[model samples]
Target: MPEYKQFPLADTAEGLTEAEILGWRIKPGDEVTVNQIVVEIETAKAAVELPIPWAGVVTELLVEPGQTVEVGAPILTVDVDPGGAAAPAPVTNGSAPADPQAAEEEMKPLVGYGSKTVVAKRRPRKTATATPEPVSEPVPEPEPMASVHTVSAPRGGYVPLAKPPVRKLAKELGVDLYDLTGTAEGGVITREDVRRAAEPASAAPAAPVAAGARERRVPVKGVRKATAQAMVASAFTAPHVTEFLTVDVTPMMELRQRLKTSPAFAGVKLTPLAFAAKAVCLAARRTPDVNAVWDDSGATAEIVYKDYVHLGIAAATPRGLVVPKIRDADAMSLVDLARALEDLTSTARDGKTTPEAMLGGTFTITNVGVFGVDTGTPIINPGESAILAVGAIRDMPWVVDGELAVRKVMQLSLSFDHRVIDGQQGSQFLADVGALLADPAVAITF
Candidate 1:
C-alpha cells in the first residue's frame, strides 16, 4: 500500500485568505525533500515561495498554476511510502473500483511538467454500444492549459466541468464551453483554457468588438486587488484634507552635494526622496497629530499617537504599488535614513519585500517627483493619519535678497485624515517640512 497524504495550503502571511499559484517547481513522480521550494504563490501583498513540510515522491498535484486556492485547501498529494508500496491491490469494503473517475485516475499517466498537451480526458459513458450520440452536442471543456492535474468525477452537463467565472470568460471570448477540455484540478475549467480556446477564432476574424475587448483579462487576486480595496476604503472612510506648499530648496540641494563628497556620506546614493523622508520625520516630532491613528475597533474609540515613527515609502513596482516601512525611522541619523531608503527601494524593485515589513506604518511619503509630475492630491494610507507627496524639483525664479534668482524649487502636498488631524496641525506639519527643505540649518530650532 502507498502511504499518501495531501498537503494543504497554509497562510503565508497574517490573515491571508487565499493565494494564486504562480508556478510549480516539481511534477508527478519527482522526488522531493522536506523544506524544498515547491510552488510560488502571489498573495495580497507580494509573491511568496512555499516549501513542503514532508519529503516524498510526488503522487499528484491537486491544483494547477494560476488557480486561486484558499487557505487550508489540499493542493498536493505526496506518497511518503513509495519504496514500501509494492503490495497487493487494495481491498474495497463493498465498494467497487469500477467507478469511471476512480478507474480513470488509476490509468492516468504522469504528465511532463508544464506540458499542456498531455491531460486526462473521460468520455461520457453510454448505456448501450449501439446507441449513437448526437452530433450537435459539443465536447466538454478540458482542464487548465498549464498542466494536467486531474479529471473530475464523471459528470453529465451541457459541457465539461467549468466554474462560473470560467463560463463567463468563455461567453466574453465567444468560445463555446463544449468545445474545449479542462486541465485544471478535478478537470475544472480555468480562465486560461477559455483564453487558449478563443485564440484560434480571434486570429481568424474577431467579431466587431469594442477595441481590445478580447485583449486581456487579468484576474485581480493579488497585490493589485489589495491596492484597489485599500484605496477605495481610504477614500471613502477618511475625510481627507489636502494642503500644498512650494519651497525654494536651494539650501537643501547644496547640502546634498556637500554631503555626497563628505567622508561620512561617501559611497552613499542619496536622492530627493531621502530628503523628503527625513523632513517628514523631523516635522512629525513637532506635530505628533500627523503620526496618529483613529482606533475605533477597541471598546472605546480613541485617537492614538505614537512617539516613534514607522515611516512608509510608497513604491511602484512591476507587481503593483507596495508601501514597505522603515521601522523607527525618526531615530536614525540622516546617513542611516538614506541607506535604509536605498535598501527599501532596492528590495521593492526586486519584488522581494515581505508582507510583515509593510505593516504597522505610522506615516508615509509618496515621491511623485520621480515621474516629473508636479503635485497632486495624494490619498492617505489606511491606518495612518497623513501622507506627503513630493513633486519634481526644477530651477525656478525666486526672490532672494530683494533680487530675482533661479533656484531649485519643489512642491509638497500633504493629505491628512481630518478626523484625527485639525487643519491647524496639518498646516503646521506641512509648514515645518517645507521649512526644513527650504533651509537645512533649521534643525537647530527643532
Candidate 2:
C-alpha cells in the first residue's frame, strides 16, 4: 500500500489562518478510532477539540503542545495498515514452559497504540561503605501523601475520591489531595470544594514574600496583542473629547422594577444596562451624527452615516476589556436586548467571543457601574466614533418635582472623536440619551 502524507494545520473554519495546539489526547503508535479526540486547537474565538477523521494507528506526533501552527499543518500521522498484523513471537527464559497463546493474546491491540519499546541498561548499585549523616528529620505526620494511587484503608477501592476534572484542578492549584475534605457525592472531590480550598484564605498567596520581587513574564499573544495594537492606533489618530452629565435615573429604576413582573419580560433579568442600551439606541436615531464614523480615507473626506445601530457593550474580563457588538440593536425589543446582553457577557467571560462579535460598532457603552466607579472618560474602541461610559447608580437627595427626594443618580460620560463628530452633534446625542433615561416614555415619542 502507498503511504499518503497529511499536511500540517488544515483550515477548520473560514478565514481561520492559524491555531495553537493546546494538547493531545492520544500518543504515537496508538490505534485511533474515528471521531476520537486527537488534538485540541485554540482558535481566535475559542478552544476546540479536533477529532481524527480516519481510524488508524498513530505513527508519529507531528507537532508538540503549545506550538502555534498555521491552518493545514499536519499534526499527526497514522498508519492505516500495520503490515501483516501478526503478533510478536514469544520466548522462554529457562524458568518454565512458556504459554505462546497467552503471549500472543497480550500482544493484540486492545485500543489505540501498543506498548512502546525502550532499551534497558543495568547500572552498578551504590552502597555506602561508611554510614552517612542523616539528611533531614523524618516526614511529619500531618504531611500529605505524595501519591493518589496509594490510598490507605477505609478509603475504599480505586474509585479515587476525586472526579477527573476536580483532580485536574487540584493538581493545577497545587492543592494537596489528602488535605481536602471531598464533599462530592459518595466522597468524590468536587470542583467547588477544590476551588474553595485553593483560595487565598485557605492557603497563602503563591508569590514569594520578599519585597520588590521580580514580576512574572507572560507572552502577549492572541487577543491581548490584537487589542493593544488597536488601542494604540485609535488613541494616536482620533482627537478625542469627553463630556459628562449626571442624571437622576430614579424613573428608569422604577421602570425596571415594573417591567420585571410584566408578561412581556418574563424569564429575563431587567437591568439598568438594558435601559441605558435602549436609550442610547433610541437617541442615536435622532442624532445619526454620533452614530456615524469618521472615514477621511475618501478624497472629499465625508462623515459616513450608518442607519443601523450596532451597540457595543464594553466588558472587562480576566483578559482585559472586550467590546462585543449587538447588530441592529435598535430593531430589538427590551426583552431581546437583555437576552443579547446576557449572551454577549457570557461569551466574553468564557473567552469564546468572536472578532466578528466585536466588529462594526457605531457607538459603544461601558458600564463602569458594575465596578462601583463614579465616572471616567473611556477611550473610543477602534472603528467607532463615540463611547458612552455609564457609572455607578447611587442614591442621593435631588430636587424632584420641586421637592427634595432621595433618587437614584448616575453619571453618563461620552467620549467622541472630535474630527468625526463636532461638539454640537456630540452634545445633542448625550442630551437625547439623558432625556430617555430621565423618562423612558420619551423614547416612544421619538
Candidate 3:
C-alpha cells in the first residue's frame, strides 16, 4: 500500500504570508524525484522554485496556477510507493480506516509538515441526477453578444496577458491594463501600450474610449509591495536634507572617451556613473559622517561608521526597483568599478539579483539621467545614510576663461539623513564629488 504525503508551503524571509503559483512543472500521476522542481512561486521579494523532497507519484494538486496559497498550507499530495498495489480508498466524512496499519500509513510524515497527526476531511459528495427534464420543442436560442464592447480575455475578472517585464513597468507607472486594448498578437499587452496608457489624456495619442468603460484595479505584490513598505517607513523615520550641485563634466567625458580607446580599459564600458561612484568613495574618506548610519534603537544613541564603501546602484528591473551592491567599492580602481557596475546592472535588469546582493549597502546612487530627467531629490535606502541622483548630461553654454563655451554639464542631487550628517558635512561632500568630475586630476589630492 502506498502512503499519501502532503507538501506544505515552505517558510520564506520577511514573514511573507502567501505566494502565487506561477506554474507547475509536473502533473498528477507523473513520477517525481527528490530535489526536483515541482512548482514556481512568486512571493513578496522574488520568484522562487520549490522542489519536491521525496520521490513519489503525484496524486493531486490542491491549488491552481495564478492562485495564492498561504504559508504552511498543503499545496500538493503524492503517493510514495507507486509499485505497490493501490490501497482501498479511505473512508470519507472524517472516518478512520478499519485497518490500524492502513491508518498509520496514511499519517506518514512529509517535508514541511509538523508532528501533528494528519486527518482526511472530505466534503459530502453531491447526488447525481438520474433523469433529464424534457425541453420545449423549437426553443429559440438567444443572440450572441456583440464583440465590439465585450472583453475577451476572461470573464468575471480581467488578467492581462503580458511578460513579467511588461507587467513590472506597468506597475511602476501606475497604469491599469484592464482598460487598454492590446495590439499585440493573441491580445498580449506590450510595454509600449502600457506607457501610452500611462500618459495624460491630453498628451496621449490613443483613441477615445466608450462612455461606460469601467475602471480596473491591480494589486501591488512582490518587489513592488516590499519597496512601498520600506519607502514609507524610511520617509517617516528619517529626517532627510537634500543638496544640489551643477558642474561642467567636459573633462570627465573627455577622459572617458580616451579611456575607451586605451588597451587598459579594453573590455570595460566606462560611463559617467562609474566616475561619480569613484568620486563618492573618494569624498567619503574626508567626510566619514556621510557614510555612517544613525542608530537610535539601542540604549545609547550612536553613529555607526563604516570603514569601507559597499556602493549600491539603484536598478529598475522587471521585478521592480532593486539596489544590488558592489562589495568594497572604495578599494577598486576606476576600470574595476566600471566592470562591476556593468555586471550588477545587467544582472538586476534580468531579474536575477539575489537577496544577498541587495544586502549590506552603505551608500547608494541613482541615475535619473537615463530616464531623461534633469534632477530630483531621491529617497535614501533604508540602511544607507545618503543617495546621490545623477541627472542627464547635456551641452550647455558656460563661461570658461571669461569666454562663452559649450560644455557638458550635469546636475547632482544628494539626499542624506539629517541625524547622521549636518548641512555643513552634506554640502562639503557634494562639493567634493562635483570637483572630481570637473577635473579628474583632483582625485590625486585625495
Candidate 4:
C-alpha cells in the first residue's frame, strides 16, 4: 500500500482565488523531487510555476490543461512512500499505450532546463470487423399535412462541432449552435457563425460577409481578466482629472544619445522612458500629493502620503497589461534606473513577473508612444494617486529663443485621483515634469 498526498493550490498575492492550468511539467509515473516544479498555472496577474512540497512519484493529475481551478483544490495526487514503485502508465482514451521512451522524453524539467526531443508517431488505424446482415421491415406513411411555414428541427442526434472558445461565445449569446450552418473547414462551427445567428430577426439585414470572413474568440482569463476588473474599479471609484502638456524634449533626446556612447552606460538599451521615469521621481518630491493614496477603510477618511517612490511602469505583454514596480526608484541614479527598467520589461515580456513586484506602487507611467500613439488618459492604478501617459516624440515647430524651429516634442497626459490631488497641484506637477524634459539642466534646481 502507498501513501498518497494531495497538492492544493496555494494562496497567491492580490488574493487571486483561482488560476488556469497552462501546462504540466510532470506526468503520472514520473518521480519528482521536493521543491521541483510540477505545473505552470496562469493567474490573473502572471504565469507561475508550482513546486511540489513533498518528493514522491506522481500518481494522478486531477486537473487538465485550460481548466480553471480554485484555491485549496487538490490539483495533483502523489505517492509519498520512499520505496514505493512508480505508478503504471495510464492508457489514453481511445488510444494505445504510449511508448515508455517517448513518455520519458516528453517530461521536461522546470524553467531554465533543456528539454528532450520526442519523435512524433501516428496512431495505427483500427480495422473493421465483419457484421451479420439485418432483417428488413416495412416503413409507415405520413398521416396529416402540417403548416407550410413551420420549420422542423435538425434531423439526427448529431451536435455541432466547435472549439471551446466558439462554444463559450454561443453560450453567452444564447444561440442554438446546432441550428446555425457551419462555414468553416470540415463543417465546424466558428465564432462568426454564432454571431450571425445571434442577430435579431426583426433588425435590418446584416451586410454580406466577404470571402474568407473569419473571427477569433479569445477567453478573458488570467492577466487579461484581472486587468479588466482593476480598470473598471478604478474608473468608477476614482474621480479622475486629466491634464495634458506638450514638451520640447530635444535636450533629453540629446542626453540619451550622449549616454549611449559613454563608457558608464555600456551594454544598456537606453530610451526616452528612462528620462521620463527619472523626471517623475524627481518632481514627485515637490508634488507629494501625486504620490499619495486616499484611504477610507478606517473610521475616518485619510490621505496617506508616501515618502519613497515605488515607481510602476505599465507593460503590455502577450498575457495582458501588467504594472511591475521598481522599488526605491527615487534612490537610483539614471544608469541604475535604466538597468532596472530593462530587467522589469524583460521579465514582464517573458510572463515571469512575480505578484510581489506588482504591489506597493506609489505612482505609475504608461508609455503609449511605443505603439506610435500620441497620448491616452491612463487610469490610475488602484491604491495609487496618479498615472502618467507618454506619447510619441516627433520633430515639430517650436519657439526656440523666439525663433521657430523644428524640435523633438512629445505629449504627456496625467490622470490623477481628484480626491487626493487638486487641479492646481496636478497642473504644477505636470508643468514641472515638462520643464525637466524641456531642459535636462532644470533638474539640478530641484
- Can you write out model 3's per-residue Cα lDDT over 167-282, one digit (the tens) per residue? 65676677766777788998888889999888778955877777744455657777788889989988998899999999999999999999999999998889999999999999
| lDDT for each residue of candidate 1 in 1-446, tens digit (9 for 90 to 100) | 55455566666676777888766788788899988988878889988877886778886677766679876666776666786854423324422234445434333322211111212222222233476677688865553222333223333533366654465567567776667778888677889998988775544764567877657676677999999999999999999999999999999999999899999998888887888888889999899999999989989999999999999999999889999999999998899999999999999999899888999999999999999998999898899999999999999999999999999999999999999999999999999999999997998799
Across residues 279-336, which tens digit of lDDT does each residue of candidate 2 receive?
9888888888888888878787777889999999988766567788999999998899
lDDT of each: 0.79, 0.71, 0.80, 0.80
TM-score for model 3? Answer: 0.74
The whole-model C-alpha lDDT of candidate 1 against the native structure comes to 0.79
Candidate scoring better on TM-score of 1 and 3: 1
RMSD of each: 9.7, 12.5, 7.9, 12.3
TM-score, prediction 4: 0.73
Question: Looking at candidate 1, what is the lDDT of residue 183?
Answer: 85
Clashes of 2: 14
Off by over 4 Å in 2: 1-4, 10-19, 25-40, 43-58, 70-74, 78-213, 296-300
Query: Arrange candidates by lDDT, highest first: which order?
Result: 4, 3, 1, 2
What pairs collide in candidate 4? 44-222
Tens-place lDDT digits, model 4, residues 124-156: 223334984464975433321111111222346
Please tell me which model should have the higher TM-score, number 1 or number 2: 1
